[model samples]
Target: MSSVRRLRPVWADATPDPAGRPVQLSLDELGTPLAEVTFVVVDLETTGGTPAECAITEIGAVKVRGGEVLGEFQTLVDPGGPVPAFIQVLTGITTTMLIGAPPIEEVLPSFLEFSRGTVLVAHNAPFDVGFLKAAAARTGHAWPGNKVVDTVRLARRVVTRDEAPNHKLSTLANLFHATVTPNHRALSDARATVDVLHALLSRLAPLGITHLEDLATATDPVPEDVRRKRTLADGLPDGPGVYLFRGPGDEVLYVGTSTTSLRQRVRSYFTSAEKRGRMIEMVRVAQRVDPIPCATPLEARVRELRLIAAHSPRYNRRSRFPERMPWVRLTSEPYPRLSVVREVKAGDGATYIGPFSSAATAQLAVEALHETFPIRQCTRKLPLVAAPGASACVLVEMGKCGAPCTGHQGPGAYAEVVDRVRHAMVADAAPVVEAHADRIAWLVAQERFEEAATVRDRLGGFLRGASRAQRFAPLATCAELVAARRSDDGGWELVLVRFGRLAGTARVDRRTDPRPAIATLQSTGEQVEPGVAPATAAHPEETDLILAWLGKPGVRLVAVDVPWACPVRSAEGLGDPATAVAALVRPRLAPDDGAPVVRLPGAGTERELDIAEARPVTLELDDARVIPFSIRPPRTA
Candidate 1:
């Protein structure tokens, strides 16, 4: 939890050079290298004076290939203690800003990943590159294999500058007319440096900067500190496997694989920060890093999944485990068969069709199937039934079934009917619904109103049932659903439901890490992070509210949906809806207020009613009477 500056190791620990001074490159060093070699421009913002005395505060890099900017990478590191006062003010970084940033050990892995396979570029190459080399040495990383490009020296060569007072980044920015925003902030300063380089390159292309080889040897000035740390990375072994860079909070800064030379590959982030989105994010989060060397690429690939699944780190994209199959159980006695729920199970051979994420979904699917075919819901055919002679059940009495429990139908006929029902439920609904619609149309055309009504009811039921059933299967794994009802106060009441359980109930998706989420719910970043907030009584209040209404006792998972006007408020204003509802629930005289108000159905002693649940509650103003509200337990519940 140290600030970004505290995350960095002492200069002697992570880099060879104690002092981060500037260096220059000219066309002469380049000799005859190609026009397009992968290049990475790097920069470091650090506590001042010397590398040995100070620490790196930030690392920023921009990668270029064939003169095109690829991407950017950067991270703030704690410097192992309080940042120098001047440093904090200049960088707009404070102790509070670094509270959650990781340390040097955690950042290295991500840095290494970003640095892989590119020539290092920097405006004053030696100054920035030297510190990077020093840091790498502390971590036992080799100097990068890539060569360097110093725009400082290149600019000197191109500009014939007798008039220049200094060879600073600002002077260069001014010379080229490139807009420079901030000077001390690593990322911003590095960007301005890149712009300066681009301008210098444009002017110097005719002066030998056009060719990569020609630009290498061009030197303007050199810092003694950079010269000492110039030894390329050494003793690196090529191996395949996952590597981790540990930081503060035991944070995993980066995860990566390598076929060879782990040190060389990981050291490049210091030399190059710009690469890809993943690499950049990794760099920003890294602290201290380490590698789990693997014997082969295949082994590395395998271990990657295992480790990723186990840790559930912030940067990984894919899941570690394959999805699971879901199934449903029917308790009736025909030896109690398990149905493979297609959406839940797909082809996974799950014996039951419904471990649906929710009871509501399961009911809908079963109902849809029942409507499509003459399947009896009698307990007699289910394994869950108490006895073979169990009564016909409510489904039969409702005329939803053909009464197959008694002598009305034989086992063979009934089993066939069940199979048909299962098929319709499992298969696409388009053909089945269309066929049923046709039957209803034919019956109505023939003036068979009774038959048409039956068909009409069944068809309507099928659509509704199917729509509801589909909500659970193949459900959004981490998202929750929100239901909103309008209140008379021109406001809306919200209901949040846990959809993840449905996915799990169906056993379609499962998490290897069972930790409740935390970071995502509190994120103020551009995008929401994954996982749920840690289970806290205060969190997920909406889910708890719904469960309370259901008379179901347990901690609830909450999801919120609110109107744009109330962006941050939860559904019901975190259970304060009663106050607002009082305005809408009043006995109303307005003609428009007469619109049907479907209050949740509920019944209990009058004393049990909350202001939110009160029926016929009178508003003090105008003696307004609120519509009666009701609550009903789900039929299956």
Candidate 2:
């Protein structure tokens, strides 16, 4: 995207203009007079409320300029099927009447011709306009670039509750004393709306809104204080960045970012497009907008996260809370068992898999792992050597637990279970997936579909959380890595990451070599310390944003301080956890063609697993595919 040079806010101390240059204003400032602008009052009758599935049965429009009718256009369209009885009663246009009429293909071009070069006016603009635009897309016609006005919004701005109980078309048409009444027919409602439009414009005339362009502010009338504060957005750069609306005493009121243009995004807060009531309150109290421009979209997103975290602005509620989700951790102790916790400390030497949405999900995932490895489920800590005279629980008698806490199972035997649990968390997941597959089949054979589904979901959540942690581990472990991708503007977008945190970013023009830029980035980048998990080093959301950008098609690694690799890589293409589990259970992960399957007590027997029954191996993100996107000049394979 193109960018404008950053300058001081409009309310800042006045700077004298350059001697020869004259001030230029946008067309919006000196707008076209309302009397000179032509408007097409339109309404539509459709088979249903949804535009995507429903077909338009009729179109009605009346073109007017300076309170005088110029022409009228009306058509009954064949919607290619029988109209529902409810719609027939509401519209009074029967399926029999539509059978002999022209289809949308024949009627649309004529309607477009009649309403060309005029502003569109409708009671509820989105409803009427949505159907028209959907029709255009369905019939291979380009939608027109006409401005639209919603009379309902106009009445809500100007009409008082005492004079009109509601802003509906019938209420407004009767209040304005129109010659026609709205009866849900296309042409009748269109003519009634024309009278309502004239009355609403007259009310707006005294508010200094005499031009067509000024109608935007009047339709959903902006408070005068908020309107004057639009100057706060002036001189903001039209580039990707974070913008903070600061209140009195220099406290940040809200923080927002735009991947396209900071200027446009900040400016929108003062317009009708920003409908949130709290945001409007934030804008009203806002004294200034501070724009923090960055080299790439990834940097802008990271900066936004950091600002929201630091300030905890009242209006920014979406991400105001810290990332405190639960993670299923393998405790680093004598007899390792699964435990769920929020905080992660570096160098713990325990397998960590999650950042699950809730503690319940983390616990369910833990149970799935326990189904394969008979790890202890008790919460109390166990010593290196079990306590003397400790009694074993019934779980040991049931063969569900090794009862390491009571010394019945030695540390050496418990160590074997811990290793397999670690491997399932960090490496291959076929073992856990296979164990659940056998139970699900047995449950289904017993006609227990709900239990089978529960088993399926538990396995899905476990693999997904495990896969996600494995995905972030490689990037979190690497101390320093620099990558680059071809920017949309034919330039290089350089990204510098340290221990999974976005350390720095830079943009190089098409004509410049990025090597020097990369060198400067390394020196200027944010210094970070690597942590045991990605969340320990940085916010999980921030890591997710950086990973998403880096994993895109054009991204290439320029250099790395160490080898970066993950064990639980995708076998098929990118997909959700449910699909991943299905592939693992059915045909994808079956033991065939020399593939090893662990022989467990409850898991399937050593039956010859059909190789063809397995899902095709996941979309490879291994070295063979990743090497192509890596442009590091001197790296050993």
Q: What is the lDDT of candidate 2?
A: 0.74
Candidate 1 per-residue C-alpha lDDT over 1-637 given as tens digits, one digit per residue, 9 for 90 to 100: 1112111111111222234321123222222323246566677877775777777778887665433456777888877777778888877777666666777667766766676877777877878877777777787877766687887777676566664666777777776665555477776676677666666655644333344533454342322232212222122344445677655677775566664546545544432223565665555555556677753333354455656666767777654322221224432345323333323322333223323334454554454455555566544344322345645657666656655545455666666765654444443344345444344333433435466445434444344333323322322233443333332334332333343221111001132221222222223212222221111111122222333432333322343332111112211221222222222222323223323222221211111111222232211211234333222221210
> Which 10 residues in a row give candidate 2 its minimum summed lDDT?
626-635
lDDT of each: 0.46, 0.74
| Window of ten residues with lowest summed lDDT in model 1 | 500-509
Would you estimate the TM-scores of all the predictions?
Answer: 0.30, 0.63
Residue-level lDDT tens digits of model 2 in 420-459: 8887787777777667756654454344556756776777
Best by TM-score: 2
Each model's backbone clash number: 95, 11
Regions of candidate 2 where Cα sits further than 4 Å from its true position: 1-143, 149-218, 221-231, 320-323, 441-457, 533-536, 568-575, 587-637
